[model samples]
Target: MALHNKIGVLGEEIAVRYLKKEGYYIVERNYRNKFGEIDIIAAKESYTIFVEVKSRSSENYIELAQSLYHKQLHNIRQAAIFYFSEKNIHLSSIRFDLIALKIDPDAKKIDKLKHFTNIIN
Candidate 1:
């Protein structure tokens, strides 16, 4: 696989590990719909979370929050809704999460990790 693709896969793997460690029960990964893909779906408490994982080799001055754009958020929301509709899940406590990671390319470990919950507004 391409280096970028490999990096993304590794990032998702790390995100899943982190979420599990934080007491989230993973429901799915790489869920796709006609709209787009959700990197992870997890449950914690009464909420079902849809996560978007973004990875970079370095922070490189750009803020992770600024890196996520409206188009991407739109797709994630659409996909999440599609997933819920298909599953017949109608819980009011649905959440959108963003997990950003800066991975050390040489070590294949996280240099930095940030999780933002309820990102949609």
Candidate 2:
């Protein structure tokens, strides 16, 4: 895999580990269709979550909030709809989450992880 793709995979792994630690039951990962892709799917309490993961190497400097684009958010929503329809899941509460990772280049370890929940309605 390309270095960027590898970083992404690592970031998703880290995100999943963090979510599990926070008591979220992992439902799926890399859920995708023609619409788009969801990096992770997890559940906590009454809320089912759709997660998007973004990772940056130590050499890269960018704000987490600015890293995500409007179109990416749009596609995530579309994928969430497709996931629910296909899986026949109907929940009263749904949430969108974004996990941003800062990885150390030399060790390839996650230096930090920032999780933003309920990004969209």
- Which prediction has the highest lDDT against the true structure? 1
Screening candidate 1 with a backbone cut-off below 3 angstroms (N, C-alpha, C), the clashing residue pairs are: none
Error of 1 at 53 (Å): 0.3
Q: Against the unseen true structure, what C-alpha lDDT does each candidate score? A: 0.88, 0.86
List model 2 lDDT by residue over 5-111, tens digit each: 88988888889999999999999999989889899999999999999888888533257767778998898998888888898878548999888899875697988
After superposing candidate 1 on the true structure, give the runs of residues whose Cα lies further than 4 Å from its correct spot. Answer: 60-62
Error of 1 at 21 (Å): 0.3
Model 1: which ten-residue window has the lowest total lDDT?
58-67
Per-candidate TM equals 0.92, 0.91
